[model samples]
Target: MATELEECFHYFGYGNHLSNIHLHNKNALKVGIGKLVGYELHFGDFPASSSAKNCWKGGLASIQEKPGSVVWGVIWKMNQTDLEKLDRQVMGYRAKDVTVEKVDGGLISCRVYQLSEYIPAAPSTKYKRLMVDGAVENSLPNDYISKLVAIEDNGQTGAVDATLVDSEETKKTVTNGDGVHTSKAIHQSEGYFLYFAYGSNINSKRFSVSCPTSQKVAVGCLKEFCLEFAIKEQTSGEKFVGATIESRLNASTWGVVWRVDLTELPKLDRQEHIKEKFYEPVDVSVDLENGESVICRTYRVLQPYSPFPPSVLYKSVIVIGAEEHALPAAYIETLRSLPEGPEHTVGPMKSYYLEATKN
Candidate 1:
């Protein structure tokens, strides 16, 4: 933590890092809202941590000056340690000191980055969604978010290969209680399969019944997908509330990514009612909070509970998971504010939740 007078600097993040949900996962301590005066946010080729050339290349974001324009974002207070983490996060950009007018009517001297080399290109659709989500989460001007949504994919190929990745930032060196070194496994490795859980699975206690050791590894966002609770169960014909992502190019779904053992695949399928056709597996890629990409599998709705509200009991399960993993505050509020129906069919599922939360 930086004190009031010890060289604490305000760092403005207008892109994906602007979301406190994303930043806190990266160890950023947001101080307040900031408006970068006399500058505009633009996309171009620079640096990246993901291997998706088309999705990440020639369209990353940086700030450019527009005489009368301003970009809005979160003001983060950083000490030396936090500064080092950010340096690793923005490798190919040149940092410059800029005075940002604080939203609270104060002037803050902060550091903002500019691309070292600007290559005109369009950003990925997913990338655009990230910026829009961040802007909304940070309470930036609504017009700026509209502008981000309007950026179409330039579709220009030949994104110059990033020269800075495979650097120190990409490595995770950890040793455990057994003196065995284990960095996280990649998506769908021999023994693990990454599962994206946006609903009841968000609640670890409930998910544990399926995969006992299942743990959410990272917070991720999927573009153009919205969560809907219309999926109905085949056997019960009751609203056994759950979330299935629907495609909506202008929307996004936030969730937790979990690494499950391959052996548990059968069990998870049973729990999700693959036999009953409630949900079917869908392979997709999601962007992690650490600026990296992971290929994961998520379930999509195959049935409908049609014209019914979610039971508060089932909704609370997801709320617990989001809280357990620290999702974006705004997204959580959205979950909490959703309209719910009666605890209509409180059978084994409700008892299971009661026992799960008890232990």
Candidate 2:
């Protein structure tokens, strides 16, 4: 008598589970790229009750039904024994039966697991890499793969409690599509805008004093602009100084990009003394370290005077901010090597701002 063969079922994988090397290691066989309709991929954590809750940091990929949405992933052919291996490997996900469309337009009933208790969050960089690698291996669409690459991750290696993540109210962060987060706002009729600061405002502490909503996102380079201490200020019965950017060939001004709420525009304008006409906000494209360029609002001295060295305290602030953002070493060295202007008597307002920036 012939023995009965075990039945096999299809499995849809949208995240790291698409990795054939990993899937095969777990005794599962890969089919090919498949599509699921009415579902979208999101990052979230495992439920508290699951032993695997501690596996993923920040967030992991999971599917949720959204009308008119599509999720692309790999399909796997696995039997009941392989299914047990998959369940053990994916700790917090509960298996759900769904219909997926293969490349040939054939519909197959598949098993996909989603986090049992979904909490919106970001994934870790390593976790994201696995998903991207698997997507590439399975020949997913480039546009769909780009979306996977755009998912932000928590800057961690292991799963962490959501409470431990910084609250959005405290510091708003926006992704630059390269896994970097920044915060700060510039003047817009209404809505958040990116602000590029290459001067003393590069200092987060100083920028926060004026634009409290500002959060440093990514370090960006303003090409064809030279950083100069040419913004002359008259106070304390003497010549004071600030930094500015001037158009120059083959020049690059490195600074921080901040995403800020529109409500902080007035505060930023006042800090930059827009009414005084000391500096003018200009729209410029800034190239980020991640090989992407963004248009940002930055300030240029309205009438830049001859080069003047900044005060020791002021120069220190710029240098500190540069170092904090890990700007080019040569640039930081140049800033440190520059001569300091004559010291001006510190005033009450200057003292207040200096103190505010210390925090």
**Which numbered prediction scores highest in lDDT against the true structure?**
2
Runs in model 1 with CA error above 4 Å? 1-4, 20-26, 46-55, 82-85, 154-170, 173-359
**lDDT, candidate 1, 69-112, per-residue tens:** 88888887776556666665676778899998987789988888
Q: How good is model 1 by TM-score?
A: 0.49
TM-score of model 2 relative to the true fold? 0.45
lDDT of each: 0.67, 0.70
Task: Quote the lDDT for 297 in model 1.
Answer: 70
Which regions of candidate 2 are displaced past 4 Å? 1-190, 231-239, 345-349, 356-359
What's every prediction's RMSD, in angstroms? Answer: 11.9, 17.7
The estimated TM-scores of all candidates read 0.49, 0.45
* lDDT by residue (tens digit), candidate 2, 178-266: 22222223333557888899988788777777788877779999875688876455433444466787654457889999988877765
lDDT of 1 at 320: 77
